[model samples]
Each structure stands twice: as structure tokens, then as C-alpha cells.
Target: MPRKRTPDAHDRILDAAGGLFDRYGVHAVGMQQIIDDLGCGKQLLYREFASKDKLVVAYLERCTQDWDRTFARALAAAATPEEQLVEVVRAVQTMVPGTRGCSLRNTHAEFPDPEHPAHQVSLEHFKAVREQLRELARRTSAADPDRLGDRIMLIIDGVYASGATLGATGTAEEAVALARDVIRIETSLPVAESEIPADVR
Candidate 1:
């Protein structure tokens, strides 16, 4: 009889691959590296993921799940939809430090072919996230929620890119302030004094 496989085998492989991909990027890492890092036999890795492309697709899906978690936390952290938008930017700002930026964005850059699975998955994620933001924006009193959503989306994209390159020194530090200002200006609501930075106030 064949032996039973461990329940966590797939996740273990994905976790290892995700770490490597996040650090060095998908193109730079290979199957052997993942195997070595995972300390699993070649057959086990292959059994779990038939090929590198499949593994990459799995990794990108996990990254999308991570974004979902960030969105949930941001959604739960604020009392108003307007504040939730800023919270999304704040959450991303806190997440991007000491990393290689957004994994999907990096993977999308590596696989420029629109036909590539990685590119397609990342593109879908972007579209879904944009729509989700627009939905949230519509809940606010902003005259043009779609424009507000796009501005917030741009802020998040900027935060991830800036955080990866500049750590705390770049526009990452300004993301929350800019987001708050954007919300205030777009919604015609004044920011609470407590929300302002001490130095700025």
C-alpha cells in the first residue's frame, strides 16, 4: 500500500517557495532551491506541485490571500468607510518595510507576457482590488467615489514601491498623511485633530 502523505506538504512547499520568491523574485529562484530550502525529496516537491509554473501560480494566489487579509483588517479598523480607505494605505505602509515590495507586482514585472499565468493572476488581482476599493469609495460622501478610489489605489501602489526602495525615508512616511489629506479634501470632511501628527499639528 502507498504511504499517506502529510497534510501540510502542499502548504510547506508553498511557504518555502513564497519566501524565496518574495526575497529574490520568481525568476531568480529555481525548483532545486525550493527543495533545498524545504529539505524535502525531489519527488515530494514534484508530487505537490507538478511544475514551476504551477508552484508560481500557487504562490501568487497566496499573495492575493495576504492582500485580502490586509483589506479585512483595514475594513475592521475604521469606523467609517472614508477612514477605511486611509487604513488600507496605512496597513500597506506598515507591511512593505524590509521586503522586496509587493510579491505580485514583482512577479508581474518578471513575467511581462500577458499570456503568462503569473501575469494573468496578478492582473486579475489588480482588477479585483481596484473594484473593491471603488465599492468602498462609493459608501463615502465623496462627490466622485470612483476618482477617490483611483487616488487611493495610486497611493497604495506608490507606498509599496517607495517602501521597498526607501524603507522609511521615502514616500512611505508620507503615505498616511497624504491619504488622510486626500480623504479630507475629497470628502469635504475635516480631519480630527487627534489624527494629525504632533509635529504637523
Candidate 2:
């Protein structure tokens, strides 16, 4: 009889795939690369994930979960809706340093076909994040929450885009300040400079 597989086999495969996917790209990393990275046989990987496409989908799903958790943790200390909106920027700023770029954006870029499962996962993740931003904008009494959310999303996209080339640290700092300014303006709050770093002021 065949021996039983380890309970963590699936998770281990995901872990290896996630690292490779993030570092290189979904399309760039192959099943053999993952197997080599994990020092496991192809059979074990195939047992956990039936195909490369399925593995990519699983990797993206895990990334989405991680992003949600990180954003939630970053927003936990925010006391107001405006602050919560700003926290979204802060969350990205905090997380971008460790990442090469936005994983969702990268996935979307790599898999431009809308019908692709990985692309769909990326789209859903983006929509969910935007909805979260819109909810916060609504709570903040913005004149137009959807518009405000869209604007903030644009700023975020710019930040991520720049982060891939122009150094994440500076870009992230500027992006957070810009986001805070937008939130304040939309809410008719005073143009407070408290959140702006002294160097950037």
C-alpha cells in the first residue's frame, strides 16, 4: 500500500509556490521549479494541486488572505473613518518594503486575459479592496464616496507602480501623505499637516 501523505503537504507546496511566484511571476515559475525549491517530487506537488493553473489560483488566494489580514491589523488602531482611509495607505506603505511590487497588479499584468483564473482572482481582490475603501469613504461623510474611493485607488496604483522602479520607501511615504490629504479634503476637514513627515513638508 502507498504511504499516507503529510497533512502539511498542501501548505508546503503553497508556501514554495507563493515565494517563487512573488519573486519571479506566476508564468515564470514552473512546477519543476517549485518541486526543486521544496525538494519534493512532482507526484507530491501534483497530488496537492492538480495543475499549475490551480496552484497559481491557490497562491493568489493565499496572497489575498494575507493582504486582508495585514490591512485589518494596520486599521485596528484607527479611531475614525478618515483615519481608516489613511490607514489603507499606511498599510501599503508598511507592506511595500518587503514586496517587489503589488502582487495583484503583477498577476493582472502577467495574466491580462480576463477569462484566466489568476486574472479573475486578481480582479476580485482589487474589487474587494476598492469596496473596503468605498465603505470607509462613505463613513467619513465624503461628498462622493465612490469617487473618493476611486481617487484613492488611483493614488494607490501610482504608489505601487512607482514602487517597482523609483524606490518603495520614498514613494510609499509620499503616497500616504497624498492619501491623507485626499481624505481630509473630501471630508472637509482642516488641511492638517500633522501626518506629513517633516522632511517632506
Candidate 3:
């Protein structure tokens, strides 16, 4: 009789795949690379994920779950919409210091085809974050919530794009300040220095 496989095998495959995918890329990292990294055979990897595309989707889904948890924690202490907006930026700032770049953005860049499952997952995640920004913008009474949301999203993209090149040079910190300034200007509020979170300030 065949030995029963542990559920942890699935997580181990994803963990190995996530590291490779983040370091290299979705298309560049193959199943064999993951198999080697995990010291597992092709059959075991295939048992957890039917195909490479499915593994890519799982990797992205894990990333989204992590982002959700981080965002939720960031918003927990925020008392107002503006504060929440700033917290979102702060959350990204906190997350960027040790990372190479955004995994979702990296995956989208590697696989540009819209029909790809990984690409579709990346798009949905982007849309969801943008909508969250729009909601926060509306709550802040911005003249144009959509425009504010777009601008904030642009800042986010800039942070991720420049992080690989300028992260250690304080690029992420500067981006957070820029985001705070944009929010203040759009909302027409004189945001005090003390109002800014210590980490972001």
C-alpha cells in the first residue's frame, strides 16, 4: 500500500515555489527548480499542483492572502479614512525594505497575456487594492476620488518599480511621504506632523 502523504507537503511545495518565483520570476522558475529546491520528486509536486499554471496561481493566491493580513493589521489602528490611507502607504513601506519587489507585479510583467491565470489573478488583486484606495479617497472627501485613487496607485507602482534599484537609498520612505502629501493636498487639510505615524514620519 502507498504511504499517506502529509498535508504539509502542499505547503512545502508552495514555500519553495514562492521563494524561487520571487527571486527569479514565474516563467523563469520551472517545476524542476522547485522540485530540486524542495528535494521532492516530480510526482509529489504534481500531486499538490496539477500543472505549472496551477502552482503559479497558488503562489499568487498566497501572496494575496499575505497582503490582506498585512493591510488589515495596518488599518486596525487607523481611526479615520485619511489615516487609513497613510497606513496603507506605511504598510507598503514596511514591507518593501527587505523584499526584492512586488511578486504580483513581477508575475504580471513576466506573463503579459491577459488570458493567463496568473495574470488574471494579478489583475484582480490590483483592482481590489485600487478600489480600496478609491473608497478611502471618497471617505476623505477628495474632489475626485477616482483621480486621487489613481495617483495613489501610481505612487505604489513607483515604489515597487524603484524598490529594486533604490530601496536601500530611502526610496520607499520618500514614496510614503509623497503619498501623505498627496492625501493632504487633495483633502485640503493641514495635516500636522504629529498626525503622521512614527514609522512613516
Score residue 58 of candidate 1 by CA lDDT.
90
RMSD of 2: 3.0
Tens-digit lDDT track of model 1 for 1-201: 845556599999998998899888899999999999999999999888889999999999988998999999999999999989988888886556257888888889999999999999999999999999999999999999999999999999988887887784466559988988898888999768898789999
Q: Could you tell me which residue pairs clash in candidate 3?
A: none
State every prediction's TM-score relative to the real structure.
0.91, 0.89, 0.88
Candidate with better lDDT, 1 vs 3? 1
Cα deviation at 79, candidate 3, in Å, is 1.2
Measured by TM-score, the strongest candidate is 1
Which portions of model 3 show Cα errors greater than 4 Å? Answer: 1-6, 97-99, 191-201
Q: Write the per-residue lDDT of candidate 3 for residues 1-201, one digit (tens) a residue.
A: 855656799899999999888887777888898999999989999888889999999999988898888779867869988778777776775555236688888888888899999999999999998998897788887898888888888988887778777773487678778888998888888879897789998
Deviation (Å) of 175 in candidate 1: 0.5
